[model samples]
Target chain A: MSKEELRMHWEDSFDHKYVKLKKWLIDGMTNGQFRFGDRLPSENMLCRKFDLSRQTVRRALDELEKEGAIKKVRGSGTFVNRVFAQPQRTSSVGILSTVLYEYIFPTIMFGAENILTSAGYGIEFGITYNKVENEANFLKRMLEINPMGLIIEGSKTNLPAMNVDLFREIQRKGIPVVFIHNQYAELSDIPCIIMDDVGSAFALTELLIQNGHKKIAGIFKFDDVQGKYRYAGYGKALRAHKIPIVDEHVIWFDSYEWLGKEMNWVFEEIAECTAIVCYNDQVCIKVLAEMKRRGLSVPTDISVVSIDDTNLIANLEVGITSAVHPKEIIGEVAAKTLIKMIEDNTVGNKSYSKVMPVEIVVRQSIANRKKMEKHHE
Target chain B: MSKEELRMHWEDSFDHKYVKLKKWLIDGMTNGQFRFGDRLPSENMLCRKFDLSRQTVRRALDELEKEGAIKKVRGSGTFVNRVFAQPQRTSSVGILSTVLYEYIFPTIMFGAENILTSAGYGIEFGITYNKVENEANFLKRMLEINPMGLIIEGSKTNLPAMNVDLFREIQRKGIPVVFIHNQYAELSDIPCIIMDDVGSAFALTELLIQNGHKKIAGIFKFDDVQGKYRYAGYGKALRAHKIPIVDEHVIWFDSYEWLGKEMNWVFEEIAECTAIVCYNDQVCIKVLAEMKRRGLSVPTDISVVSIDDTNLIANLEVGITSAVHPKEIIGEVAAKTLIKMIEDNTVGNKSYSKVMPVEIVVRQSIANRKKMEKHHE
Candidate 1:
């Protein structure tokens, strides 16, 4: 079938001017009117053929391109996705989260579902609860369901490999897999949507430094990929400022200890520091509590800042001056990426990795220490 | 079947002491070994006959009762649930929440899932995002699915009637409905698992009074059922202590406006109050930030107390003294009740309404104003 034939079919398929042009493209591809590697009608050609706006034509083409149903080259016309042209559309995508309905997962799931549903896909979720047994159970269920694609927010991305074989098996079954939040260390070839942890942390630490604080202590988690990047960023900011990165000023703890009894020691160790750089809002909030317990005032006796500005943190006593978490956008991008991989049959290819941008949120947590010193003098 | 025959079956079912007795009971009914309203063997008789521990027998019976497979009448033997006798087991229950990922919802959902899954039921969640349209959409979807039961965390419980007809329709389909956190005004016949808002708030306010606070101001949300109860409790505490509930000291705002510019007015209005009683941790945190900006020291220039002791409040600049939210227990109780209603086919019979207890968390936010006055003298 030629481009002209496909154009005629699209125009004849509907009476309304607002006919779904994207669906027509998919229908053409499935019926062999547009075969693998066949060039789609140019945007202007599509607009003229269908009597549609250029914007409408481009939008349809863009969606097709996004889902791997079509790929656009800089100088060449868009081609049908070689992988997606043959298979029928799968009704549902499977999503696995460590803990559903908690912290940021619900919003992420919500965002993903909104986009996926609009694109004619349903979501089936399984909870791993950050446990190996639960992970195994969910993986087994995913295998049974054999969903169109799988999106995993792994239970512990840094742990010794456990579900590597299962994930590999999923890929072997022709199901696309995309990881979010944390990716498995062993599966480096898989596409991932991860945070710009190092850059965001570096920016956050630099913000504190720019606020005139020299003695900045850090409270970080040591059990995941994010913690390492955040800690390194803190060190980088200190090095750039020519401030000594003292070993005793750093407190390395896991998620379990944020509100745990070890908080007393964390506060005691950071006593002499003028500013505190925390890993996330949960840790920062705990540090603030400890500061209050010791009769220390925030941004006065000591300043504070962290990464991931959550709602709880935003509405806190000082509305934590920190970095914003792009959870919704991450979900949307990750969902779109996975769907594209599924459509194009590019699940096994190590062709995509996204590090979404993070921005600073200026609140009341940080203080100008130099001004305080001047006032004291 | 006779008691002897039932015991014989139980003994022959498995070798492991930790056998799945609940499945066996369901199987017995399906296979015609048990019938509707048939009285089962006494716990002691079953224990003696099957050579099983009384604890195991009771445990199995307890689960059967929760799933509405049986009922234990005082001074009589346990009888099979009449409604559960004929229908095949439904594997899933639907849950709807206004927002699923924020605040204390994650923990509540976690608790509910733990109980439901253990009892062999799956959860299908719908998020209303606190919008009427979304609520209607979810309700329509739930009706199409015709789930075994429904657990609703309403969009906005205090709003004018919108979902009452949909809820009534669910009951008409013979599907049980249970509400959590808040209940709709028109659906008085449905069971609800709500917080003891008034009692908890009274306790919190009484605590502040005991600590020598007389001039107490409140920042409350007026758009939910819980807020109204909490406000009433606050008033009750004030009146009981002979402290006037001043009009200017009370600031009423909605959930949408908590982080809005109206907050500036909230801070400005509460300037003269020595102690501020907040709606929840989120509000308390905001109030604290405002105090910091105005150079008012917590427990010194002013004191604070609030409802719902969340992680944010626990780890604040001043660990807010608060009334705890029983979200987890509420979820557990609500899920169990809904399951019972589903199994027993009691969709419209008002058999349950639970108000889970709340306790006070004494932290540093509340100060002894009388003691401070004496010290200054």
Candidate 2:
């Protein structure tokens, strides 16, 4: 056909009533007004809404089905198709974290990067240093990039987030964001991949209790949800064992207060405790350093147990009995969930949130106080 | 004083009427209610608000002045001191950008990093890749970190920003943010260090017009404010020279569409023009490659002019006359401005926004069309 004829034909086809109806449906799905697997309005409803004829509406629906934009499930209704609803403009995923190279963050990032790169998607990565302000900045940048999906390790998950509006805006724009490690309570509808902090801390505390250590002191972080959950677990274990939970035996520190003086203060508060449960390996290491300075030996003077079985604990003279953190697994699961949501064009699908179970890694850090008592007798 | 005596004295001192009034003033400054250099309430107003006697209020003002938290002028009321208002918690600043390694970004980052590091402040860095989503993400992260200050190159600055709330929140928290390169129109209140894009583009285009080329084709980016300004300058230059602006000779492409095929399409649109003005060095390089593919020689066949005098143009077989981008200088100014704001504890101060002047470098790209016409005769 001549160029003029092609133009005329294109204009006529696009100007058709059925084609206009189809465009409206596509626009709705693209904007997340109609998400993946969502049932479209009844044919009669669409016809009335668009002021179109029944035959035109049916034609539009049939055309959409042919194009894989929707599926008609026999007797039910037409549903938005997951695969076809995806706007594959850029094959890139945004990955955000509080810390990229600290503690277990590197492994988590590596895990997510492996999955994303192997799937032929580029990565836009950022770190927030566990600060809500930094999280807000990174989220704003992510919104500008408009990646196919986002996988983020939330910052200060224990606190109320001021960036919930940004998260909601992202979802409204049809870009799925999956939380790794934890999520904001305000945005609880978003899917997440997280380790069971409460369960892990419970198991760790129980192990110490099983070793006959009743006088246990807990050192926990106050800024993150994981820390709160771990503290709860510690309290739960002590309660279950009928041990008195002394206020003086609990030491709470935020991200900024983990200094030499803070460690000394922690020891002073828990001076009479036989065992200590730390928030993480970093805290455990600090406590151990303080013990060493005081010329005390682990398991002999005081037993130390913590969560996050990082390599930092392995380098120590004495092994720390702790609960394992699913670092890389959290990243991998988060990436997979985000990719699924992106491909399916689903927004704020809570079904994808997975809390992995916990496991204890026994080491020499825990001492059997009951055995020690028998030996003394 | 003895410990008990000291405690008693502290309680007595703090419980005094003047001390309570002093605490309120400090709190106002801390929360950004009273900014640096802002005039505090009059002594009479403070007395009325606090229901304190004139002597008590005078004592409070005297204590504040003695501590350098506020300054009292002979005729005016006391003002918040810039030096004393800073909350010196973390010695770090966050630096955000759209691209880190591309074009002039590295040098710009280097300049800022040098200044920030030399000042004994650590850096928290992130990039948004010219995406609004990424900008939102990074801004959120910056907010969480609560860095002393933030230096950022805006993402998709020509468009309406969805991250303005995030920026406003950062300011509300009293964390100063300085924009490098360009800023969002919605956030015009934020300080920025940017080059004169409009004047530079105008000069570049006028240079071509001065070389006696009238039928000039222009290729410009559509997504950034820089592109819009550059296009405006180009049109202004054409109009100044009494050259009729032809719609067919102007081409607009966004961040996503500057590929080989797009360049070919651009050329097809401006096939009749004798010379071309490009958006930047990157676009100019692409145009050069396309012309080479078509076996057209620069200057001998058609002259090319562009902005951003990057090293890429220096390596070309033929030199292309372009405007200098002030790459590193932009970074230095941004860093300095941010540091000043941070130390002063000022938020959203527009006076710090610096629009650096532009300069053009004459190269071998332009052909003397007038000379060619006379030689043909």
Candidate 3:
């Protein structure tokens, strides 16, 4: 069919002019009007035939070319290619998580899916399960795919170093990468989305102190970067309140398995304490269970508080008072900032990071021992 | 400086041809060698002078042009524009959540951020706070930003319809959108990442029955879509064991606030039951607290179990046995599916949904009442 004939068959129901033009061409091709090796109308011809701009015609044609519906010869003209039997794999973004099915990671992954998919990009996902070797392997595999961008949740980022050169190699290859939750010290040049762990931890400790708790115990993770910062905040809060950092009251676990095996250490730390500051809800639960086994009640015998205002704490009848982790905002900000870097084509150009603010959630796990003292007096 | 002079000044340490060219141009401009509004050497001249291909020279020029360092007039050669004062705002992806700072949403937001940012796209976030009006307003506001794509967590999606028209309008406008958690009935055409609520709830209920608890009470939410599906699962489990769905033993709460005020209902329901099935950890906690107040111990007087394998129950001394929620996997799959739709440009073209798999976490809350009866005999 002639270009004019094809233009006349275009539907106006579709609001997008490019979409309408695209549909018309697709319909004509499907009906065998446009065949293999057939030369389609030139950009100028289509502009006039459809009463459209050269830009609009070119856009429709560009899409057609991408889907292998057409091909262009530099000095010649546009010719119809075969109708694609299989869809093409376009540009993609990769997301590497330490753990894929636990805590906040799932939601973060879902959030990323929402943005990337809508923007017409594919996703490549990998799980490190918080292991250094797994992270290395995942990064290597991701490099082979060479996605448009990469999102990495660092594994054991609290350690002095691991996989810095691998991350640098990705940058050198012109691929944009952003870190989530934690980042390595050697990879300081990389942008990361992090929680305000220090501040929130400090606030949680302060909350316990305000309730008249002089002896406090702390449980922290040794492998994650957030644990270090949170511990720092814990120390700051203790120093600020004129309470010495009690060495015996502090415990650090390397992994969940380690924590499970070292339940005795938790007991040792909490023996002389009136309040306990846990690394997260998981630690809080373990400590609570142990306390209950020994016939100790929450807040009355000793107050309990932790960071991360998750359902774990929120679901309790008398919920564990917590300092909120700005989980969603961290995801949003990190995605935005990284995208800005990629679009600006300045990946590896400069370091950018965001520390999201947190809030304290008050609940029944924290009690005012001062009130009891007044009754005793 | 002339093209030959610039070529002679090129450094050997820079690996990328574009990087070398960019650095040369920047240095020349800063040193007044290439002044404001000055025209640069032609692409052919640079290729010849630097012993590079025309493609290489052009690539360098493209980078310079993107940075606003040079402008090419229709007939005129490329000339210096100006140093970029600030980076431009690139295309953005939008995320609309029911609540931005709440438990699961934050992590989801963070995950999305990790993906979007790395791909070189910014994020525009909005929160519905689980209110229909808020959802409508956020959707409308998101339209104003004209994001490349959208990810929405539906607000109370079980009641048939609320924002169907608004969501349809978004799809009609050619913006890709994917839902998380729950989807409205009228908008079934849109894809959603959901949990296997029915199967998981059934497993949880079956667990209680397996422990010889014939009388099982239930607490659920009325507004959220998951509540209904979970309730269905609960009934199926009971019927499988030939236990009637006791009307008085099932209580549904609208909001967390409602659950707090309706403790009496929970107490009443559990009065004659040997076990209870809660919608989530929050309800489980409330029941545990009430049970404690009445001097009732878990798995002794009554067994308490819930869905969602979060730290809330995990941290308890006698943790609540739970059916795990595939939180991170949900995000990953949802984001992947949505991206597939967008990249294929099939927005509103097909219906896609994924019900993530779940696992039951066995904890100490459940007791084998059959053994207790044998002991009594």
Candidate 4:
């Protein structure tokens, strides 16, 4: 079976003989005909083996690649598709989020990716940009990559038809998936890593109270899992302390992805509260930047504290007081869990949850409320 | 061609004939037999027509997939591979870097990704993490994803053997890969994007001199390309002003990545200079953080400026005056050039290079040299 012989067969055959070869290739992968990083013989080898031409052989391999069948490593050669190659180790989970370079997502995702990668499993990532279609598309690609488990940053509920389809496909394919930060109650079977929002909010709020700040302010993002939880915590903390939660004191914005349009609005709201708690580190960073741009100073005119602990925030020019979540811990657990499910195919219908302990790091962002009457918008 | 017939064909010899059928499927895609986004007939359709079983029919179709042949949408019928099926206008370009999330990588990478994505071309990304293995691995993988071009963030001069082999393979395959941020000046005829370090450094130093900073302090990373030009610039600027740069004010931190282990030697030099211009933003940020950790304030106690215009510096609590490079434009031009090479396969034998522009953003980090002396350690 050589290239010349194969070209002749293609001309002679009105039969669909190619389909059988596809199964053979897949069976070869499942049956260990190829190892994870092993590149198969060139199309020439396959052509000679099967009396086929180079083009015919390549066509067969190409489709497997498209169907998440194999990974064609250019220059190195084509290898067995790892997305479906090995039995997934709990450490080799995949993550798909709407954004990768955000304040919170990285904090959470890096934790998971690092833990998993350290445990000898690789983690591949996809970004969705908060769009349902993109999420669905990313989901499809992730599945084709054949990760043992998935950790989606946002809730799977209220998504578009395509997103739902992707989730359904993952389930149908028997792949385990996890939701993180926030989730839908109805999706209880899906494991998740969530923050203890109400508790954290209450704790920080009490800190403000103990600092003698009655006119405290809360600034956060809206329409997100973490944002809602932080807000709820703010409210619960206020109610428990017998302090009124004034809507005016709560200024809201979305994720840092689109933070600028609301800067002016935040300026108008700054005059209302003695102290401010930002939703995450990025918002706090932006607030500080904008305020400086407008010739305003922090702690002197307005005291501020933020949530989210990045590697460098503690040592920043302004020591930011923050509630830090153990992102790496959560990431490791998710990877481990997904790997377990992939290996045994028995991470049964249970919604497991892990909440890493969070504590506030007191920095320079907060101070006792001052009697300032010269507040200008 | 139908399911019933394909099942019958499974019992036949699994040989050359299957290869032929696979090519026809591909030929169909190339010949406009199946339009872009159009799904081929079902497995069952092939089964009946060829008198092959579901298994055998799949084998023939499988071969059509492996070589970038086609895309098989789950639940939907398999579609022709976009390489031949879809037009190049819908194609995407990719960006690959080592440790993309670190220091200035993300800021520069993001700027590039944003610009490319906004231009109606999809951008795919990969992080090589300064590892030759990872770099080589990603280089192959990036090519497999079929990017029109690539923007490599670091110097290829440092790549390991395997990576070098693969990179050469990329050139052999006629795909254009452009180097950015770091220069490949030694390698004749390598395509690259670079900053005017000699000119910019001279400018940066002139700023320090103009601000009355004769006893200037410098902490730098001693990399050949940027470090060489920058150091030269500083010397040239000093010569122009009839000022001598005291060697004591110039301290070379071999790397910030080494956790400042190499910086112990620099402690003695900080107090000598009134103003310190750093090699890059990462060094500047780290030094700033270290200084704060040591209870020193920037600009007030010791003025600082650095290279690289990343948002990381912008997000810093105190703004540092620094040179900003045109990162996104670099990415765009690199990608466009690579795409051209990939398409025309007409890369010249000589290396090509493009020098990107830089801007000096004056922030609060730099102050008059005489004023900086008051706060010098």
lDDT of 3 by residue, A225-318 (tens): 7877787788778768877655557666654334443466568646988888999988887887888788889888889898877777677766
Residue A311 error for model 3, in Å? 1.5
Chain B, per-candidate TM-score: 0.75, 0.84, 0.73, 0.63
Q: What ordering of candidates by lDDT runs from best to worst?
A: 2, 1, 3, 4
Taking the tens digit of each residue's C-alpha lDDT, what string does model 2 give over B268-297?
A: 878989999999988888999899999999
- DockQ of each candidate relative to the true complex: 0.01, 0.01, 0.01, 0.01
True contacts kept of each: 0.00, 0.00, 0.00, 0.00
Assess the local accuracy of residue B63 in candidate 2 as a C-alpha lDDT between 0 and 100.
Answer: 91
For model 1 chain A, give the 10-residue run with minimal summed lDDT: A253-262
Q: After superposition, how far is residue A120 of candidate 4 from its true place, in Å?
A: 4.5
Highest lDDT against the true fold, candidate: 2
lDDT of 1 by residue, B56-115 (tens): 988888878887778999998898764442245356899988777898888899889888
Which regions of candidate 1 fall more than 4 Å away from where they truly are? A1-377, B1-90, B348-350
Q: Which stretches of candidate 2 lie over 4 Å from their true place?
A: A1-377, B1-20, B31-51, B54-88
- fnat, candidate 3? 0.00
Candidate 1 residue-wise lDDT, A45-109, digit = tens:
77877667888888778777776677999998898765342355356899888777777777888
**Model 2 clashing-pair count:** 52
Label model 3 with its docking quality class.
Answer: incorrect
Per residue, candidate 4 scores C-alpha lDDT tens digits across B149-257 of: 6677653232112234456655533445677766443344657777877677778888978877777766644423466567667767876887744545655432212
TM-score of the first chain of model 4: 0.67
